[model samples]
Target: MLEGLMLGLQSIVEPQHFLVLLIGVFVGFIGGALPGVSGTMLIIIVLPITYGMEPISAFILLTTIYVACVFSGMITAILFRTPGTPESVATVFDGYPMTQQGKAGQALGIAVLSSATGGMVGAIFLIFLAPVLATFALQFSAPEYFALAILGLTVVATLSGGDLIRGVIGVTIGLFIATIGMDPLSGIPRFTFESAPLLSGVDFIPILAGLFAVSEVLRRSRDDHSIKDTFQKFKTKIFDFPIIKKILTTLTRSSLLGSAIGVLPGVGATTAAMLSYSEAVRWSKHPEKFGKGAPEGIAAPESANNSAAVSAMVPLLSLGLPGGATTAVILGAFVMHGLQPGPMLFTNEPQLVYTIIISMLVINLLMIIFAKPFITIFSKIMNIPYSVMGPVILLLCVIGTFAVRNSMFDVWIMLLFGIIGFYFDRIKFPLATIILGVVLGPIAEEEFRRGLLMAGGDLSIFINRPISATLLGFALLALTLPLLKKVFSKKTQPPPVSG
Candidate 1:
């Protein structure tokens, strides 16, 4: 293991490789710090740009950006209440509160420290346990995958921003939107209304752009209030080992949760972050303090998000299964470079696997080294006027969605969703739930069909397979636990007073 890692490090130590890693991190920081843009979008846009580059160099650069964006999300979340990515939504709960309390620097420091630890833990797991985990991952069948998606969908109830009903509504809307394109099993289209573009289903980029970025821009546009604090500086450094240790503990828990979820066939980073945050809240001594400036709040989701980012690579590299949309994109990148990723990847191209792992570690170290001094500078992005910044963000959204297929239709779809997103925001709907539905809906549909076919359309098939049964059992627990808690709480509580 050590020898392989050393060989990998040697490969990445080349000047050109170092340059690729540096460029990726730099781009990632900007992408993540900018509101309305995500690391995934940046990577998708840039994938074509890396067409002629060596496979290793391209993957190294892309993964560096992927990892860096996870960390840089804290910048916007802490300085402004706006989250740069859905994964950082939990960060805004506590991070912005710290900023409001004049502890922006301290919050930023903690976020960076926690994200590094989370990312490092994830990288370590990828390096050491990818083989073992891949074996377990292969055990999943269609029913099991369906159950996993169901489990993820249930998290919407917990992450409904304290409004369980609204969360359910948001999830329903998301599911409906996901159904807009062609039907998965049948050739007949469902809700496209005869538009050719709609036959492909709603594009993830445009929907996500509308839901997250454009909606946020509109929401921020309505707010005329200015921040009261002239940004304050704290002497908080990344090397504060005591704080780092505490942050590590929190990140470790979240990372483990994320990795486990990512190893599952269909669930992805968004669900991992949401579930981790919910678990963090459940485990906290003061659960009510969560979403009200609790440090653990930020740490949990950041850790989970980064961990899921890495673990998603595992299935793609080892099982020839893309764990999520981003990993699917990465898989395409690998194939473009004439490399096939699967179990044979390890034995056939051990050096390539190790190089990817080592590059992750090195890129993280470089990101931390570079992000420290600029923490204060990046936090100042909060001061930019909403009017000036919002249009630029919208423009980027337009460019990103259009760049995906170079289709004017996608751009129009983005604008249409932007309006839908604006209304969803006004109605207190959760965008994360919608994105999860879109990402996971097809998986659920495919698996549900496959499982039924295997059982000859017998409903008992869900219980016939042991793995399927166990997964369904877990899904039931996920669904019922919240209701059980509420029921028990109500039983123990006094009646409300009349107004």
Candidate 2:
């Protein structure tokens, strides 16, 4: 592992790779600081640019953006009570309060410091845990892969903060979308509607651009033209050692919790951050200070959010499953590059894989420098109005999607998915699940069919395989546990007194 990591380090320092890494850091900070721009959206918008680059460089840029953007989102959440990303929502609880108290510097400092620390912890998790997971996954066959894919979809739906029915609905949409092209086993058109363009099926990039980026444009179409708000200005290094000592416990706890949660497929940093914040409140000596201006409050969620953001790579690298929306997009990058991420990737692309792991450490260190002196600069970037922001991003989406194949049909597909995405958003369906379902649906169906063929049409083959059965068991749990927990919680609640 150390030898691989050293090789990765050497590779990243090469001129081309290093330059992209720096660009990722810079772009991520600015994009994340913007209220309407998410790391996922930024990745999709800029994805086409990476088509000409090396796979390692492409991944380094996207993953770096993922980590940096997650941390920078707290900047706006702290300064303006408007979270730059959903993952930063918990930060606003204490972050903005500190700003209102004229301690914005301290809050920003604590948040950034904790975020960096958390990222390092997550990197450590990736370095140590991912390889082990990959090695174990080497034993998987078609049955196991199918079960893993099913588990991935279930986890996304269950943890995505909505009713199971809605989540299922989202997954169904993605599965239907996945079935648009030729059958893998049989060379037959499935849903082309006699259209030549549909013969190639739907491109993931255009649909992704639509669902995330262009849909964001329509989602913000109703907003006022100008954001008349400004940051509570502050000055200081984005680190404070004195407070770090006080919140060490919070940082350590949240970082571990975040990295662990990150391993669960499709459970993103948003969930990790909120859970960590609540855990901080549960365990704090002065819980009352949390909603006011508690440093621990800032540390807990920020640390977990960034840690989970980085560690989300673990599943993507090891299991071929994305742990969140941003990583799902990263998974697309892998596929675009003709690289399927999984156990085989570790064997086939050790240099690229290890370089990515090592790059996590680099991203965290660079993030401190990227954020420290540029708080004001990022603040200005975030203050740009949605009206202007929306149009620019929409234009980028069009240009990026069009560049992929130079086809107008692809552009039209993007627009069509945009409306689907808009409707999905209106119904409060999690986009991540649809991405997962679309990505995983093919894997599950393909693997199931392949497994059955291998088993000579015996239905018991899936259950007879130990690893496959275990994975399916977990999938069942992922699907049912959340609903069971909700039911139990409600039933255990004291009945309302006839109100």
Candidate 3:
């Protein structure tokens, strides 16, 4: 292992490999700062270009891009309330609120710091715990996955603010939308209404773009006030040691949570972020401050998503299983180079694997250095008049949405979702809850059905497995805890001052 690490370090320092890493990081940063442009899309675009490159260099470039892009998404999410990727959706909850309060620098600074910390932690786990975590992840079957998804769905309580009913309504709406495509088991459509595009279900990128980006545009358009007048001066210094110290606990907790969740197949950074955000709120001393420019808010999701991005590579490296869409693309890149990524890869190409892992650590440190100047530039964006910025954001939304599938159908879907998002925002509904439903509903349904099939339609399987039972028990507790607390508090409180 030491010899492999030395060799990997040597390879990354080579002039050509170093240059490729820098280029990848730069391109990834730009891609992730643009709304609707996800790391998966960027990898797909750059995959062909890597065909003529050396295998090690290609791997380094792609992996660096993967790590950098996950962190970069928080930049736009903080500055403009627009998440560059689905993983950064949680960042928008607190990041944009901070920006609105003239604390864009602090928010961006925390995001960069937390992301770097999380990435480093994940790299450590990938280096030392990959095999162990992969073995543990192997224990998860359909029943376990279904239970985990249910546990994740319980986060709706945290996102609902004070409106649990409305949150459930939002989640139901999202679940319905997720069901629009073909049935996972049967070869039949449910709610496509014979539309060819709906057969593929709602594309997440366009929906995210519309919900956050286009909706913001419409909301701003309704206001007669000029954006420039309300804009605060951009802060130049991006680091705040005091704030960093303040949220170290949240950062550490989120990083661990993200790395753990990332090892599970099909559960991506998005879920990690949402779960981390909910956990942060749960453990916080002042949970009411979350989603209102709380430092812990930015720290939690940014850390989790970045850590998840790195640890998601564990399953692929150890078991040849892609943990998420970005890693799925990297898996294709592996096959393109005539190299497999399972346990055998370790023996066959030990140095190569170590090089990729080491490069990720270096890439994350470089992101921190590179982001400082960029944060200054991004913070200035808030000063632009909404009249000018709104149209540009809309154009980017249209172009980015169209670019996702190269279909005009997606553009229309984005527009429709933008309208829906605007209406939801006006009605005080929780958009995050709906997004969570859309993202997790399909996974839960498919896993539940698969578990039933495995059990020959017996419901006992869920509770029969210890892991699944524990997770479901946690979900049940999570669902009932708030009400239980409310009841208990009422019993303990003084009798309304005996009035």
lDDT of 2 by residue, 1-499 (tens): 8888888999999999999899989898988988888998999988899999889889888888888899899988988898989999999999998999999989998998999999999999999999999999999998988888888788665445667777787788888888898887787998899998887778788888889888878888866767777555578556466887899999999999999988777788999999999999999989988899999999999999988988888999999988877787888888889998899899899999998998899988987886777786766665567767777898899899999888889999899989988888887777777887777777789999999999999979899999999999988888888888889999999998985
Q: What is the C-alpha lDDT of each candidate?
A: 0.73, 0.87, 0.80
Write one digit per residue (lDDT tens) for candidate 1, span 1-499.
Answer: 6887988999899899888988888888877887656765666556656766877888888788877877787787787677876678778888898778777767777777667766777788788777665455467677766765676566565557656677777777777877787787788898888988889877666777766667777777777745444556665566666666655666778989987776664466777888988988888778898767777887888788777777777766665555554565565567556776665677777787888898877766776688876665665665666577677777777887786667889888778877887887787776566665665566667778898998889878777778768767876776677778889999999999999
**Residues 1-499, candidate 3, lDDT per residue (tens digit)?**
6776788899889999889999988878876876545676567556656777889999998898888889899877887777978889999999999989888878888898899989988888788766554456567788987887777677666567657788788778877887888887897988898999888888666666667667767887888635333435565344687897889999999999999988765567888999999999999999999989999999999999999999888877875656655675687578668896656677688778888988888988898898887655655543455577567667767776776667899999989988998998788777767766766677779889999999999999999999899989987887788778888999998887554
- Per-candidate TM-score against the hidden true structure: 0.72, 0.97, 0.62
Report the Cα lDDT for residue 248, model 2: 95
Q: Select the stronger candidate by TM-score from 2 and 3.
A: 2
Total clashes in model 3, counting residue pairs 3 or more apart in sequence or in different chains: 0
Put the candidates in TM-score order, highest first: 2, 1, 3
Which 10-residue window in model 2 sums to the lowest lDDT? Answer: 230-239
- What does candidate 1 score on TM? 0.72
